[model samples]
Target: MPIRIDRFENGPNDVLDLKAGTQPHIVLTFLATNNEQAFTQTEIHEATDIPRGSVGVVLSRLEDRGLVRHHGRYWAIGDDERLASYAAQQAASSASTTDDYYGESDE
Candidate 1:
């Protein structure tokens, strides 16, 4: 894996990166996109293709941070305002990375 050293010489106003492809991030994204619904650990594991144990652990961690909510066996994205900004930044980063990789075409 290549290390990306982000230098913010202009002071700290940059968007907070959720570190793409991480288990927690993946689980959060899945719940966010399906905000209208909730799922159990098994369902989330199947949907996100993450290990069942990992899914449970990640969900617990996210809940501790108030990023997700649960009722019995079901889990859903929490109403954290920070999530809005995080999602926006993540989307922007993904787009920029994709554009950089594919590059612009004159045609």
Candidate 2:
């Protein structure tokens, strides 16, 4: 059976569990890790192999969410804290989902 989404509550924030292997997750992780640098669409497409069109869409969403910034001809990370928080939330959700898949729960 498929496991229900694992979510956690932290005060006012409701964080949902997300699959970490998705293109968005991968791109987010990459951008976050290389926060000190910037890259153009072509460069990102080459490095991530995410297809040029998808790269543009991903960048648009991330920019709207304030997770990334567009500077001149390149894109760079916007908020490091949000990126870290998102990654952490995804990780926690994944862990619980794994435990559920194994019919185990950490009490």
Candidate 3:
């Protein structure tokens, strides 16, 4: 008999990268957009489409950077002001790394 897995997972040797808060930043932004609520790792994994292992690692790095916090068994976004500043910096970095494909004009 063959085993059936539910959630899709990356290979064991796949590289894990949060892209210096880019991944988690995007995830947090989406979660915040939906609503500010604590979610378990499994929820985050499914919501973000990130491998379970990578989700844990990314969450750990985010916690270390004070971008997120663990309360009880769930995790939540950190301070709003702090998150805003951090996300701004990450966006700036992303912008500098890639040109604006949208052709946005400065006011």
TM of each candidate vs. truth: 0.63, 0.58, 0.53
Top model number, TM-score: 1
Candidate 1 lDDT: 0.79
Candidate order by TM-score, highest to lowest?
1, 2, 3
Residue 23 displacement in candidate 2 (angstroms): 1.5
Q: lDDT, candidate 3, residue 95?
A: 66
- Tell me the lDDT of candidate 3: 0.68
The CA lDDT of each predicted structure is 0.79, 0.72, 0.68
Residue 55 shift from truth in candidate 3, angstroms: 0.6
Candidate 3 TM-score, C-alpha based: 0.53
* Prediction RMSDs, each to the true structure: 9.3, 11.7, 10.6
lDDT of each residue in 1-107, candidate 3, tens digit only? 54345323544433344453576765665444434578898888888887788778778877777667788778877776867665566566566767867577787
Q: Which portions of model 3 miss their true places by more than 4 Å?
A: 1-22, 84-107
For 1-59, candidate 1 gives per-residue lDDT tens digits of: 54445645544553333577988889988777676789999999999999988888888
**lDDT by residue (tens digit), candidate 2, 22-79:** 7766677677656668899898888888988998888887777777889788997776
Worst 10 residues of 1 by lDDT: 8-17
